[model samples]
Target: MTSLPARLYRALALGWLASKAVVLLVNAVTFPRLHPSRPSLRPRVSLLVPARNEARALPHTLPGLLAQGADEVIVLDDESTDGTGIVAGCLGAQVIRGEPRPDGWYGKPWACQQLWRAASGDVLVFVDADVIWQPGALDAVLHGLEHTGADLLSVQPRQRPVTVGERLLTPLVDNAVLSYFPYPLIGLPQPAASMANGQVMALRRRALEEAGGFAAVRQVVLDDTEFARHLKARGRRLAVALGGPLIGVRMYASYPQSVAGYAKNVLPLHLGSRPLLLLSAVAHLAVYTLPWLVRVPGWRVLRVAGLLERVAANVISGRTRPADLLEGLLGPLTPLLALPVYARALRRTVSWKGRTYPQKAR
Candidate 1:
């Protein structure tokens, strides 16, 4: 017989699994479908890309951005030693030199501020240099913005995890995003509930200005989420959508790279609260990893949890594989893999592109 404490634990785990299942089911049913309708007001759009040593990836990605049919495309070179600026200009982008790194400001934000100054468009679309846009992406984004009447719309581009490490980490990263903001609840009048992906974002010029533009979030590590929060606080409407067939970004080429990328933002996410970080890590481990370790009364609960997590991953990632869901069986290992990244995030002051910023400084 299971002890009272064990029984309670089982109940909690089962409850968590059920909640995940419900969220997955709801997302599957409610994720917005793309019905292409061009905006009546086709605001002139400026496409802004921040490039730093992205020469290898830019050639593959810049052409796609150029083909998106925007009014103007600008690539801001952030002191890249690589030929990012030259390659971008060759691909028909108007390249601009980013200002020198200023204290108390993140690199990407600085590049964005420069792009804003150089741009002359009513709508501004910020895309990372690594993002590959599919045809009709710009059209779809404008359509979504007009349809929702939102000041800002951020599309969680489909992630292509080509490596073993990426496949393992992708689901966890995607799950964290999905768990934070449910798709259906976006546009609700709650300031604390908005979410965004920095991979691709579209914003009305006036709304960007009203939210104090990129300057408002200059010091933020997770500038995308912070920008959304700023818009929400200003009572500007915000929307998030999956960029199905419209965009994709390969975030990291290898496991170590992926871990480093995550470390940059994980600590900053908790807003420097060590206790909150610990609590969140524990809760994530419980919901995402503990099921496989505990011996529940039946395989039914385990199977259900596995299936639900897969469904959630598929919906969030916009890719379906029987193998993908089966992969949830390996979810117990996620915490172990993420632990080192979390530790590094907590202990180290990360230096990116020759500048050092302590994790605790914020």
Candidate 2:
């Protein structure tokens, strides 16, 4: 017979697992899918790319983007020392020289602002430097926007985690979304439920201008999320979609790079609260790591729940390859791997792409 305290602990863990399972089910059923649909009225589209030290990636990505029937493809060379501008020009992208970051402005927002100013299209599409645009991706994105009548349509690119380290960390991105928040809430009039993926965001040119453009989120590290929330607060219709077969991105090449990239955003996720960050780390370990290592009562049930959640996340994100399934099986150990990322985020300053910024406080 279990002691009362042990029984209470088991009940709480089970409850947490149950709540997460419900969220996953909601996401699996309600999350929007991006598919190619021709609009009745064709809007001129501008594909915008912000490049910094991305000369190597341009060759692989630009050609596909150019193939998309856009009015123009523009690339802002964000002060890259690696001839990013030259590469974009050679690849047939209209390259714009990015200006220096203004006071209290982050690099990405500044670059995006310049791109917005230079763009001449009714539909403004922002693609990150690393995103790989698949066939019919632009058409699918336009379809989603028109069908949903969304002021801003943000699509989550299917992650291609080629490296071992990438496999270990990338699944958590989908997990963070599908596990914590129900997808339906995003369609409701709730600003707090707002979420966005900067990798592939499409907006109406007028909607963007009405929201004060990228200048509104100039200082935010997580500019995509903040901007989405900003639009939501003003009663703008927002649509979230899975990129599926149309879009993909490989964010980092190795484990060390993954760690550094994740660290830059971890603290921001917690709103820069030290106490909240520590608490989240402990909660993750308790729920995800402990069951694998400790043979406490009901550990098997907890382990099964964690595995099922991981598998569900993989399926929803279109990670059905055998290799991807294996990575999903190892998702339980990501909490242990993330401990180092949390530690790095706890530092006063974090660096990315040759720039360092002080961590924002809540």
Candidate 3:
């Protein structure tokens, strides 16, 4: 016989599944498909890469970027001790020395602020140094923006997962993003629904300035999401797409590094609300672990619930099997992994790239 709590949990799980199914259906019906043959009519674009101790990855990433037919590429080396500027410069990108970061600024935003000021192009493309662009990637993004008349176009760069830990964590991150934002609905000019990826973002210069540029979100730990919110608030049209063949990113070299990387932003996600952080952690556990818990009843029921959860998570994340299953198993543990991150975030201080920033309360 099913206990009351187990039955209640099952009921909650069913409700969650139904809600997600509706979202999936809506997304399927509304998502816009990119037409590859369409040509972009926009003016030239400037590709800006902000680098801090990214020398190891720049060599591979820069060449891929250079091959993308952008008008110019500017690399802002933000006091990197690893000779990132020299490497980027040697690869044919114009290198600029980033100004000293002000108190309210984070590393990438500080560099981006300088790059935006220096760029002369009508369109500005901010790309992380860790991303590798494929051929026609730049053109596709430009075309998508021109066709949609969107002020900003961001792409979800495909991430390369080389290790077991990466495979587990990557899907969890992707699922969290998709579940939170539901991309298809986001592009429909709604303020309440908006999302963007920091890996590769393309914005019109005028639109960026109109949205208060980087200065508006300088103090924000989650700059990408904050910028998207600001743009929506300003009524600037925005669209996002999966980067199909356009770009790829290798976020971390090892498990510990990946955990630390996520910690850097996960806490500030709550804007310092401990309750919200705890709630988020609990919700994550429910979504990722409930299927497994349901399995304790019997193999047949467990198999069915596991399959349903996997399908739901897969649709949300756009990731494949085996990997998704692995990530699902690991998702419940994210709260534990996030504990130190939340503590640091609560303390309003986080260290990244060998530099620390005191968190400013929202």
Which candidate wins on lDDT?
2
| lDDT tens digits by residue: candidate 2, 15-64 | 99899999888889989877767777879999999999999999998999
Point out where model 2 deviates above 4 Å.
none
Query: What is the lDDT for 39 in model 2?
Result: 72
lDDT of 2 at 37: 72
Better of 2 and 3 by TM-score: 2
Worst 10 residues of 3 by lDDT: 296-305
Clashes of each: 0, 0, 1
Tens-place lDDT digits, model 3, residues 190-218: 66577778888899999988776799888
Q: Each candidate: what lDDT?
A: 0.77, 0.88, 0.73
* Cα RMSD for predicted model 1: 2.4
Each candidate: RMSD to true structure? 2.4, 1.2, 3.1
Candidate 1 local lDDT, residue 139? 86
- By TM-score: ranked, best first: 2, 1, 3
TM-score of candidate 1 relative to the true fold: 0.91
Q: lDDT of candidate 3 vs native?
A: 0.73
What tens digits encode model 1's per-residue C-alpha lDDT throughout 69-160? Answer: 88999999999998988988888899998889788788888888888888998999999987888777888889998988888888877777
